[model samples]
Target: MATGSRTLWKGAITFGLVHIPVGLHTAASEQGVDFDWLDKRSMDPVGYKRINKRTGKEIDKDNIVKGVEYEDGKYVVISPDEIEAVFPKTTQTISIERFIGANELPFVFLERPYYVAPINKSDRVYALLRETLASTGKIGLAKVVIATKQHLAALVPSGPALVLSLLRWGDEVKTLDALELPPAGRGNVSAAELKMARQLVEEMSGPWDPADFKDEFRIQVMKLVEKKAKAGEGQTVLQPEEDAPAHTGEVIDLTALLQRSLKGGGKPARKTPAKKAGAKEPASKPATQKKAA
Candidate 1:
């Protein structure tokens, strides 16, 4: 579970006669290793330079101006003062428009999530709202202006805290009809195929465990980095097993594949590659073993 961090935005939830003061805290963070660019010859850090595309000349910050391209290759430069003049008024309030069933909104509409906490001794009111939403299985549809742009968001209760998830505008979501997909039940799904597929799904179903999911690629990459740093340059590092070759231009037997997968503990075993000629294989230890000094 994520704990509350520094407050990002402060506001009040308002709809009808009800009002609850709250503060929004960031709920998630980006994960993965960040690599910096470097000059290979000098082994020095490399920095990005702003360059004019046509002239291939470096540009300075003062040389740039904000503009909107209303016509092809034609832009109207707008100043910071002009933009701030027309900015949406920051009411610092989440004006909820209506309440709907919690499940009514599609998952696709939800975007960034933030943890909502009571501010300025409004704990009791916050608890009331959270309990009411949890008991009734309802969520609040609200609009808020944050950082300049206005956004539609869903306010719902999760455990002890209220969560406000930013939503995409209706126009932002593409229509499903645009894709030329086959209609439901229009594809050639035989009775036996359907039955087997259902059985496979049922057999594989289990309780949701988020802890079981992990970024194995990131883990392995970091491990490789550690090994290389210890081994220094000009050393060969052992590799992990690669995935089997994908079938190409051949007819696939979906039913047979499902049956075999189900029988073989629901997952296929990976094939280890053969060593190259005259390459002596080292004794295998855990992948995270420290390189010898």
Candidate 2:
């Protein structure tokens, strides 16, 4: 956890008969350019305002209402009280429904993540749960309500911390049936090519170090902004002061470069060979499926 990180949600993780109190802190941050709309003439900041679509006039905030359109130009107004009646209750508990292999989750289903830290003298139980999941190579499939919205999440043991990664709803991810991809298998690839590809992968394989990579685009943009500011090209706009902060797999072998890669030698293979003797065919069905609602 980073210094001064605030806990966004305080809750208890419940599975079976065990309960561990914990706090959820944000795990990631946006690193994109923040471009504000500005008035070019006076160097003032431009802000959004609500205007009547038909009358082309500004309306008071009190007069605005929420509505759902059922017909072309017809709307059914919904009141704040009515919306509140249907919102999911904040349970303040992450209910683990079941456990599954960590690899069972598809990458497309992953959404946002939050760091889970033990709280209220629950450290022992929290450590127990984390170590159990890590040793078993499994993750807890859980459902939690955050900010009044119910979310599907995975309780994963990441090093010394437990991470609650929110997952996309099953219906939110599109099926691959729409894609025109090649069928999975050997599919016209030769054994020699596979061997060379494996060798190339071995040559490139290294330990995962996130610090090795960075947001170059954001860095460069900030650099340009700094350069412009130093050149007196920056403008000062009036505003209210507020505190705020914010893989493909393929195999092909052709050239001598690949031969050199094979000959240059790399770290000894950590994974099973590409082709194992008497290996059984992989199961057609996925090892695990998303739990039904």
Candidate 3:
């Protein structure tokens, strides 16, 4: 696919021996209708007005400066120059601090994603970092300042390119322990239950594949939108049924459990030697007949 020339954040990835200059480009985008608030009588598009909550009056942009309330009912205004003074001058480095396993970080910590590409003709260095991370099964954790605030990000090998996922800081994430919950409190899981879960898991194993999944809701919504546009009338489409997925009990063996589950559950699988052709033969066998004298 052809890539856009928009650079979200221009920076460099730093490590022990690697200081690869790269630019961060957004890897994804939101696609949908853009709605505007308008004056119904005149059909004039409305622009938002900044209003004071206490006074219930519109405030001018010049009067609405950035401020943080240090005390009750009072805020000290800060200027643009004050904000600019803290901004980082260099927009050419990612500055990797350390490398750690990707799974070590919680999913809640990940906030945003950006594609990292080498600067000018530094493709060689970019490829080196991508390959190194891929081989070692590790992700690079780095701190880079973009705009005014600094961000914590994880550098990961994403297909032919590198992706940097912006992460929430230590103070940003509140631990679940604050809820005063007991150990493994919510889910009523036990040893046998865990074993059954494992059995079900082994039964439904499959290779990692991203192409198999997609945003079905998005596709359907777009289709409805296109139909309305052509018809010149808005119409709602019926939502599809949410079927409960059948989960098999966790089998004892991860490998064999998958094969048997596929056989029993009537799901077609690969024709490997381990995955037999007639997995349901044992279950389908008829009872023995009595012999007549």
Candidate 4:
């Protein structure tokens, strides 16, 4: 796939002694519908203004300062020079610290993804790194500074490209200790029901084809916008019909659900293996014939 020409960041991948110059290109783009706030009377676009929340007064750009809340109702003012001093050095390098199994990292840690490619004449080293990582099923974990912010990133080999996925630091992720969660086990699930569920899953299983899915809402919205533009006037349009509600009852019948899920019918029960052909039968007794004679 062709990546956009815009290069977001310029850097190099650095390991022990290997250094490969590279650049980061955004892998994904925002798909949100753009909207503007307009004044009701004049139909003019409304703009936002920065103001002091306490005094409700408009604040000037030069008066703004960065501060950190040290305690309740107390903030420590920090100067721009002080923040700049603490910023991570722009080394123009993605220094990989270690390699770990790609599956070891949880999905929650992953943030944004970018396509990384060799800059000048580092194609050979880049290919070597990509192949090595792909063969080993491992990804490089490194700390990189992008857009003046430090981020933990995972260097993943995705097809013919090296994908640099930004990750949240360990401390940035919140712990799940507060929420009450049940222990992992067979929770009210019977063996027969579980077997049927597995059968249903097997019956419904298919290949992962992203092309089959689409953003239907976006498509409809664009169509509506075009229709309105062509009409040249505000006109009433019929809304799409809502889908029927799904069953969400508290009492659930797992057996019925599993049965209905499998092609809208119950799956056939397991059967015993058929006996081999030409198998010898037990010999008939000869004593009864001798008594009759």
Candidate 5:
């Protein structure tokens, strides 16, 4: 009985010994300045029109055709059929390839994320995908062609919902080994400094809480803009810049610490020894204040 105008992308999730039909709906959106070309002279609307650079004339829209270039002087014209041939025949299913451990790749490789939801009495199957991934501590690697373009996506379970993050191909990401990296050498480090560093970290350590942090810049910007608009000024105001604390970290000391850890136990924090549990020491008897008569 859900109403209103939100259409879900109907699809089927596929994996070995598992296949579930589901639908994907966008959980978020980018709502910002939607820029458009304008005519400064006329103060009227300006729009895009097809113009041939070589012909020096505006070409009719119907006459235009999409083409792809392979070489300096080679090209291939692509029709609607040519493009459709590559897309999944039905838009009803997003086929999942395999599930993988979340930490198998770094965050840098993650691209854009979308919320995928179930559609039309598909909650049971949707829950299956969500709980299965959640229990395994893994994300599903899947291919979904939305519109005419195919996407390499990672289906990550986010609470009761699922997040599909688009991924880049292996070839698109350049190999790190091919690049010149910084030297792995670790210079000598003081034992005292290392101990202090350990103490500093211990002082600041706490459990992970995602809700503890947010984009302060974005929130500040929104507030500032809102305040300005209420005062009838539409201009965007930049916040005053704050200077970062001086970084006195030396490269070698860090590397040495890392190596020490890898070689089993770098250094433990010096903590005050706790009093023996359940063994209360006798209270110190204060000398009775002798009255000097």
Candidate 6:
């Protein structure tokens, strides 16, 4: 249950009269090769420029204004002051609205996940909350404001840690009615076919090991890069200045918390299996790889 070095947001988890101070750390990282735009001749980095779309001329930054479209070829201009006034207030609290069964949440609504770690001597209360959720098989439906935007999030107990998973708003998800999908519940399928399908699934099903998957595209691209670098064909690109690190508050002793939770009959975290050596590519390229290419 090691947390990330940097905390993106410092907040408190609140439900009823309980308050547990916590910090949100990014749980995921973007995976892929990042290609930067550069001037071919000078090898200088190229950046975006604001331009007047209709006039075909570059525009000064001061001339830009925010607006929303009301109708065709019409817009309602909004000033910076107005936008700031309407922005959601940063309450610095993950306010739990209600609790729902673990299975009740749909996978489609899940957007991003962050590790919620206890901070400022709130480990006991955090552990209590995590254990309660785990024992009851429930997840807290909460709203949290981060970077001035309010997000619908699920407070889920993940082994020794609590995960704050951001969810898309109800209206953000489109209805499936427009698609011509087959009717639900065994429509036009034979008993023998169903039996075979079940058998295949049972045979293939095993423990969920994340190491089983690998980003083949990234690996291949990195291999190509290494080959070119070894041949002295690499260019020296200037590195951009890094942003100041976010304030990481007091670190919690997760090991002790986990031990206490497990002593209360909580299950231990699952161990990830070692990745296979010399993994071979699939016989055919996967659909994802094809799309990426």
> Best candidate per lDDT, number?
6
- Which pairs in model 1 have colliding backbones? none
User: What would the TM-scores of all predictions be?
Assistant: 0.53, 0.59, 0.54, 0.58, 0.53, 0.62
Where does candidate 2 clash, by residue pair? none
Predictions in order: lDDT? 0.56, 0.59, 0.54, 0.56, 0.52, 0.60
Off by over 4 Å in 3: 1-64, 88-90, 146-149, 180-190, 232-293
- Report the C-alpha lDDT of model 1 over 1-293, residue by residue, as the tens digit: 23335668889976434466777654444332233333333323334564555455555655554555456555456666887787676545555666679999998788887776554344554566678789999887776666556778888888987887888776665445433446788279788867876786677788998999999999999898888788874466799997643311222343454355356553312221111111111112100100000
Better of 1 and 6 by lDDT: 6
Compose the digit string of candidate 6's lDDT tens values, residues 1-293.
22234657889986434466877655434332233333333323334465555445565556666555456545556667987887776655665666779999999789888777665455665777788889999887776676656878888889998888988777666555443457999989899877976786677788999999999999999999999999999999899997643332343455664465456453322221111111111212100000000
Off by over 4 Å in 6: 1-50, 56-62, 231-293
Task: Name the top TM-score candidate.
Answer: 6
Off by over 4 Å in 1: 1-65, 185-187, 222-293
Question: How would you encode candidate 3's per-residue C-alpha lDDT over 1-293 as one tens digit per residue?
Answer: 22344667878975434466777654334332233333333323334565554455555554555554455544455566985786564333455656678779888778878766444344554565678788888887766555434777787888897887888776666544323345765377778866866776677688999888999999999999889889889656999997643322212233454456456555222222212111111111111110000
The C-alpha RMSD in Å for every predicted model, in order, reads 27.0, 23.2, 26.0, 30.6, 28.0, 18.9
Clashes by residue pair, model 4: none
> What's the distance in Å from true for residue 81, model 5?
3.0
The per-prediction tally of clashing pairs is: 0, 0, 12, 0, 4, 0
